[model samples]
Target chain A: MTDEQRLYSIWVYLQAEPLFWLTLTIGAYLVGDFCYRRSNLFPLFNPVALSIIIVSGVLLIFDIQYERYFEGAKFIHFLLGPATVSLAIPIYQKWALIKSNAMPIISAVLLGSVFAILITYLLALAFSLEREIVLSLLPRSVTAPIAMGISELIGGIPSLTAIITIITGIIGAAFGTFTLDLLRVKKMSARGFGIGLASHGIGTARAMSRDKTAGVFAAVAMGLSGVVTALIVPLIIFLLKI
Target chain B: MLESIFLIFLFQLVGEMIQKFFELTIPGPVIGLVLLLVALLLFGKYSTSVKTRLEKGLTTTAEYLLGHLPLLFVPIGVGVVMHISFLENRLLAVLFVIFSATVLSIGFTAFVMEKLQNLGNQNDG
Candidate 1:
């Protein structure tokens, strides 16, 4: 048989298993949640973190390609856009509180992004890492889609960006409030805003777990900070020529 | 009733237009949000029924979403499937970035507010 025939056979096999990764993705989600609930340590057991690790392991063990996995899992992926859009409803509902705190929230997101990017970049330089690593590191605080775009535009690897993004979210989920309390941040609004700005979705989840007020601020901050960081981080990188 | 429907339509249209044009990087609903906030501020007075309906509709959706927010990461998780090689080479550096940024943001925000609150306490003392 010629090479053409072999390629056709592989394509045929791929077409047959459209829902494979979808099942795996859902399985990973459920199992990850189970593991998180079982584990006493909330941070270590973060469902998002665990699911990614488990699914990656499963894919690797079975030698499944990402594109093929994504083909089946893309239904889950498709929801992210709408979910992100759905975040606006809360922001609208909380208009009065948000309006009162708009200036402060904006200030926090800007300061938080600068702090996140600068510390990551400076520390990476201190450790003598290459430029690509630094670029990928820069957008770790943003949500995955926005971070991926920022990383790609400034020449960072998207895969590295994805991993770092997850790590950021998990870390934010686990320790955000602990650190906030250590510093004695009593205001739920500020705490939520800071977490949402710094950690995106995971941070927002953690915030929501705290209170309705935290959740509202988290939704606003998560959405708003995405806009701020995506715009500002690239411009800064361009200007600094880093 | 008619006014509320009109509000949704107007807000949604403006939201989509902002998204299409400014690429504000913000979600359209958020843009609609700013518009809503502006109207609220400008009107400075909302009837009880209108407020109740809008708030009720918005809050219900928010509550539902808040429940499953963690599940949304599944898509980005799939991104890992695509870029395994890059993940292999730069695990530490990526880890460092995540750990440091997460810790730093939480630390910095908390620390600054603590200082301000302390200053306020000192003044009262």
Candidate 2:
């Protein structure tokens, strides 16, 4: 084959390979990290958020589907659970602080969970959106998987819930952290759970930037809120008879 | 360090087992975390060898994983780009709710938690 033909084949191979997206993700993050460090600002331009925008741009430019990107990216996704479980390390380290704050933690998660649900529903209704759309939007604050499950359980579309949850997660990670600082919240649990309760895993991931202890409580909120939302949402819907 | 990572996965596996056997809706990794916490409280915290090994594991796992925690969330976050059209007509309301609710919840959580902390402090003093 001619040299041009060989180069064309190689290009196709790169596109087909999962290495492509994986490398792109790492590379973009590297640039994001560099910029963050150079500027000496965490809130101004978060590396994760920057890298995502870069990767999304690349995918759009190349016309690559999310499925193909996920084929490589799932390795990173798989780690979310282990990383979540790894939170035990920090919790174990900070047991004293956590134990002392138990009452507040439980109270915050409960109140925040309730507020997340009611607010999402009321806002959707005020917009005059359809009932099915309302059902879909209700679970927007929970973790994506559980939120999608809750959506389906309450007669909402799962796919829509998944996307809504993702957007919420992005907002929490990108905007929530900066906003938290702007609000000047002092308590670690509040800052962490605020993001966690409203945003889920991504929020907890964002919470990690604050401090290990804060990240642990955020994880606490994320995990418990999942259970709480799962249990209560169906009950609420059933009672309302909607 | 390797030993600690192994322990995390071991706990995760058992957590998955417990989840399946009991039909728990809670995620396996979460269950695994509680199990690890329990084990640490009972066994690791008090024992020097266990503590050393665990600290090594925790730091290594954290260094390798935690620093890039946000990266794990990228693919899903990027997926939001695909549904822009669906959101167009309702974009104003949807964006308004998400932006406002998220801000409100965070503020509310912090406010309530701080108030509770003050209440506890008052009781103590």
A1-242: candidate 2 lDDT, tens digit per residue: 99999998997888778788788888888887788778775654777778888998998988888888888877777887788778787777767777787787788778888888887777777888888878988878888868887887889989888888877876777677677778777767667767887888887887886567668777778878888889888877777675
Error of 1 at A39 (Å): 3.1
Q: lDDT for every model?
A: 0.70, 0.78
Q: Return the clash pairs for model 2, or none.
A: none
Q: Name the lDDT value of residue A167 in candidate 2.
A: 75
State the lDDT of candidate 1 residue by residue for A72-165, as single tens digits: 7777765554445445555555666666665566666677778878888888787777887888888888777678878888899776787778
- Quote model 1's TM-score for chain B: 0.62
Candidate 2 regions with alpha-carbon error over 4 angstroms: A1-3, A36-44, A239-242, B48-51, B83-88, B122-125
* Model 2 chain A: lowest-lDDT 10 consecutive positions: A40-49
TM-scores for chain B, in order? 0.62, 0.79
- Runs in model 1 with CA error above 4 Å? A1-23, A152-163, A181-184, A234-241, B1-55, B113-125
The best candidate by DockQ is 2
The window of 10 residues in a row where model 1 chain A has the poorest summed lDDT is: A78-87
